[model samples]
Target: MMRRLLWFSLLVGLLLVVMPAAAQTTSTTAQVPEAVEITVGDEVEGALTEAAPSAEYALQGAGGMLINISLISEDFDSYLSVRDDAGTIVAFNDDSNGERNSRIVGLAVPEGAVYTIVAESYGQYIGSAAQTGDYTLSVSEAQVLRIEYTQTVEGELTSDAFSLDYIFTGSSGDTVVINEGSDDFDSYLRLLDASGAELFSNDDSGGSLDSQIGPFVLPSTGSYTIRAGSLSGEATGNFTLSLNRIESQAIAYGDSVEVEFTNNAREHYFTFTGAYGDIVTITADSSRTVDTDLTLNDPYNSQVMFDEDGGSGFDPEIDSASLFADGTFTVILRAVDSANGTVVVTLDRVPPQSLDEGSQIAGFSSSRTQIPMLFTGVAGEKVRLTLTSPSGNTSSSLNLDVRQDGTSIAYANANTLSAITVEFTVPNDGDVNLLISEYSYTNFQFEVTLERVG
Candidate 1:
């Protein structure tokens, strides 16, 4: 047992994450069979020596109770290890919140039982003669945070204790949205049932590297746990946690709703009723300077279709999309890349633009605002697509992308009315897309012509 304690003490610096605490300490020069008697809230002074290298104190508590243990010393770096009746280490700490003093917060005992608290110098057992020190050991009940729906709270995560849990109660059929935002660290969040089963988890849905879960509908009426933490275990900082109960907004066909993007990574959800196999045209249009994105989800919260830039000038449009199920569908609007701003999303009854031989469409283009046109092509068919700006004297540069399905097959560029001429043999017998955009941020008027060559 003495050799084991020394070996484990050597590992304190290497295993910084979570390892069973080891060691003990005593004021007496000789070792004792039973540990010194101590109780919660009582400050006991003890010293580590070569003869009596460690000491253990017994703690008795009820089931599911959480406790905080601390070992503060002026002599040397202190370490604390907690063990159950079976002598198995359950919790341990060498430092708390980046401090040298040892402390463990929110340590919960699943069942009512007695445990042993071991105290010693950081490297005392490993023969570091400088580890001899006097430490004040204390224990106290842990604090539990209770959250209410629609309420927000400020929280912090230290390097030692990087995660915190908050409890809340919700009724069945309620939709809840949880947001954990932090500028200091990337946030990660999880919701667990009373039995500690994780129902949902999220990372980076609450916009700009924040974590969000929901509009998640509650499965039953009961208390729930929200574990607020960071995306990286080493990340430590302050954060804002919010619990919001939301109602799905309703939208109808032919309705145009303007959404103001609050962040670069946001999920703005809306609902609409759809009939079986009904084709709908949905478009999310923003300023010609920004790119927009959107997704269609079925009632089950499963995505049906997504579009990033299918609309005119860097907008996302799901044109003539046939619904497979008849129910309330969800539409989530988002910003593409760094394009965060306002967008007008409309659900209209229209047909997808399909260009044929000799067909031409005139449009405007700007940097990051690309205009995409659809065309049908047969396999091995030779075709030429040309984009001319003004009277061959347009400002800014234009680029052309020939894509089969969603993958770009060819690329070309031009500066003025000097048309971007790219001729290629059709790789497949399907729909081909031509995306035209300006390389320079300036806006330019352009006309795209598609002609099949014999």
Candidate 2:
């Protein structure tokens, strides 16, 4: 009878094990939905148990609209699977350490797609120790942001001028306005396109003291950058920029010279002069193809001067042209395009007559009435005189007195050296006096050259 009772007790225990409450419910019905909550700076959780096969969930639409997914579970030894409604496994997380309790899984979902998260025991476990845990799921819409910018110049924008306000806009229909404040600095504002291409930029206007404010239009509906900074010849300042939409043409002068395009082609002329040793910088800009040429021309319409070829295309640069005589000259830039566009050109002249190889002098005396010197100059022309000594040293004084046929043509002192350049036309043949005198005993050196500026 006791043995019978023992056998009955064992049978009852087996029945209880087979009908465990947690294991029975696992296969009885579909998995129930769970809730997940999150706060800023907190790691997202709740995916581990929700992704189990026993807790089946379905996602809707294309996957791209689904931005992100996350899960958390204390069952570190368990495995989790994430799938779409079509049973496509999108993500999985597994841990073999049974002692560890925390686990997480995440995936970026495709837009307009359905997804499911499933958790299950790794191996064949008929009823793995009555699996039980609380799980939560959460979904939120993704955010997209974009910006567009445009700039325009309304009136003359010059070196010392005021510009009008600028405007700006955002993807969510937000707006801003920028104004030029008094800061005494030259500033530049530009617009960029979606592909990181510069569409427009503006500075001071040609021959003007102030720059005008204008509107800039973005080429497409996407992201963009608007930049502002100080340009050359001005101090830094606080300026305002705005975002708005308006219809206007972006007309920018290329450099110093103002160029206009009527039929997509035009030409302009300019002139410059300097000492024999100075260098000049020339710059040109055009929306269409352009060509520049610098030539030395005679007064009789004959091309007697140098004609350095100014190459084709926009913004051609050339440097260092020497003057051989004292006369009028011309530099020309030609811009052309099948499409209508404008060109702007500028020339920065540095007088080359300041010094060359011939202006050095050697002497040993504190007081000298007349000092003889030799200089190579243009035939029949007088040479300008310049003298230099140690700054703040009056003892090392010197004077360069220039003469032609015993008549004083030019004189220069060490203190006033830079402003003493003289222009004298050569008579086609003769010797000119290049004299030097010492006011006190001090070593001195200088450079001299002849310049022809016709």
Candidate 3:
């Protein structure tokens, strides 16, 4: 009986040893730890050297759990993927280019359920035996306000006499007061006039925070536009604008005018001296157009002269007339309607010189040659010179010299290849003569006219 009991005891001990070995094999095949107890600030680390088909873990908390995941080692390519109990992957970062230190952050893991974190390596086997580097996963809550907003102004606010138009809209207000939260982005606003001019603008300077607000005023309240964009040219946000009623005024021409234009079109006014052979200087404000043909006529005689266009329609001053005849003369200046508006004209008189009938001169050449031709004339008198070339050949150069007896008063050169116009004034209203010459071997056609100015 004693021998049988001894044998039975030995068999029971052997069963205990074999049962523990079977349990160890089962645990190894499962691959997951029985109970992973992780605290709020603790980090879990593991290594992976190859692609993982599946992985998992579980949290114990009830609410507001956050996770920051990262690759902890730089030796092998590390990629992280997270999945819920049903095997749906919720977060992942892969080292697509085989980078050794690939990482991503703030992946949320659900509480009370198994959250699987799978690490993968591009070219190496990943598991407990073949893994080469460690990956870290952490948990926490995320902060509010992912990105702040801002504003900025672009383009000029003023040009010429009119103020530029500006516009401001979106969440960005006109008077933004910047604060700690106003650092991430920018906003834009502008106010434009009827002429498409920008008058005012606002950006980040008026905001309390980076995000936009309201209470922006328009330069003048007819119809204004607004736009908003990022200061760094990236990121997404919004802006807005508020408008109030305001009074405005505009200027217009009055009724006390010699030549009145009833149609809202631009016009020019010209006046001629009726008694004295006086010089008249006509000045128009830059707001008015200048440069055109000024024509003067008496009962039997009339004359026309060219005036130059003015720059910067702000302060336009043109010497429009120089009268040498004593008869009653009527004047009119003509211009193309380049703009829409009323133009104002002002006229004043200066001293004039005595008139004289200039002597007519003519020149002819059989072949293309330079010859010294001379003629005489009076100062402040209209002088006309004409040259006719044979029809076929037009390439030639003509030079003219005007002199008082032997003293040269003026010289001019012209081309027969193209029609030329030359006008000059005589220094003295006395006997003036002219000399003509050529420089090229071709027939020429030319005409010259001169009107004196006082």
Candidate 4:
């Protein structure tokens, strides 16, 4: 039988009160026997020597319980490791608590297994000839928290600056929102990875004095931290912290989004990929009782267009032309005030197309807006224009015109249940504009065909 000697060092503190050491056990066949029983809120003091490099304790708790273990030592660097009864390593920590101390905080233990926690010195990494020292080991239970809860924290700022941290576990492609807007202080927010690297930061992004940091799509799966603080670095007061998971709909052309705006002021985002010279149009229709607003942003997050009542009545529309680049565009739908209603939004693209002589174009005239078409003609060429409204629908009527260099060449109008055609000869070789103006507002389809004639 090999006798293992246990050592001890002293640290005077409330949570660091010393306790007697447990019997040391050596693994005979890679299986350590008779671990010390350490329950929650218990602190055990022991020493490690180069001869006996590590100490083990048995952690007993229910599944889903948050187990926190810390190794605090001022004499030597501390390190920790956790393993199950099968000798399989479950978790480990080194230098995570700062100042060379070791800590494994908020580790969830599953059911049906006894966990062994080992604490020792960081041998070669510490670069010290004396590899043994005393450490105060503490095992405590923490409250398990959900991700979507709103917490109100009242704190004052110190010279070191005041900030609060909340842990969140997320997978790839998940969008998380952190909001700290329900207070009077100017708020700031930052999203960080496990290593404390900033992924995204924002100050005053939630509008006014509030702060918001997402709809941020996580790029990887792991533990992330959201930090909330004051933008002034010294402001203090009561504030509300809200952490939540949000779902955004994938949207593009020909798709409509059903939206409702509560009194809390909500905004919805949509994405569209476009190219230079492409004209993208977004229209919103709301109930007569609700007034809506629309905003389009380029890939660079620059505002492309914003409309409060550009559409007929209180509806909103955005017609963007000559996009500067090719990438995904973002559309934000909002309400003019606190209102709840359904809004049907549509995305329309008008890419550049050639319309030479004898070319025809078809489109819908239900928007009660002007539709413009471009065509080319040679000098001394005679072109024919036609506008045919939907027959059997008496509500359909439209006016058409041909123009060059802001000068009109020919014009025609069709009343309800009628059609119009006009012919004209071109004086120069260039592009001609065909304009369609709505004579009456109704749901109908109209077509225009062009032909060259002597």
Best by lDDT: 1
When sorted by TM-score, best at the front, the candidate numbers are: 1, 4, 3, 2
Sequence-dependent TM-score of model 3: 0.25
TM-score top scorer:
1
* Tens-digit per-residue lDDT, 310-388, candidate 4: 7879888875333556787767777776777677778887653346534454454333345667687688888877666
TM-score of 1: 0.46
Alpha-carbon lDDT, every model: 0.73, 0.42, 0.41, 0.67
For residues 1-454, what per-residue lDDT tens digits would candidate 2 score against the true structure? Answer: 9999999999999889888765756444335455222321233334324334344445443243312233334543455566665877766644311232213211345445556655444441244443445443333322222233444322222322222212234443222222232245666555544332355555542112222223222344555444443454224444544344432222221337566655523444454443322234555555444444443222222222222243244455454343323444345444433444455656565432323455453333422233444344466544345443324334335566665555566666665342235666544344455555554544433434455464
Cα displacement (angstroms), candidate 4, residue 207, comes to 11
Candidate 4 — which residues are off by over 4 angstroms?
1-34, 62-64, 124-130, 145-240, 243-250, 254-262, 269-454
For candidate 3, give the lDDT of residue 178. Answer: 17
Question: What is the model-wide C-alpha lDDT for candidate 2?
Answer: 0.42
Q: Tell me how far the alpha carbon of residue 341 in candidate 4 is from the true structure, in angstroms, after superposition.
A: 10
What is the lDDT, from 0 to 100, of the residue 268 in candidate 3? Answer: 39
Candidate 3 lDDT tens digits, 1-454: 9999999999999999899888776332324334354444656775443343223445445133444444445655565666666988667666422235444333334445566555555343244444455566554332211112243333221111011122323232222211112233454444333333344444443323332222223344243333233343233333333333211111121212233333442333333434332345554443453333333333223332223343234433334243434554443344444433444555565432212333232233343233333333455655554443434345456666655534565676765443334456555654554445555634444433344333
Ranking by lDDT: 1, 4, 2, 3
TM-scores for all predictions: 0.46, 0.21, 0.25, 0.41
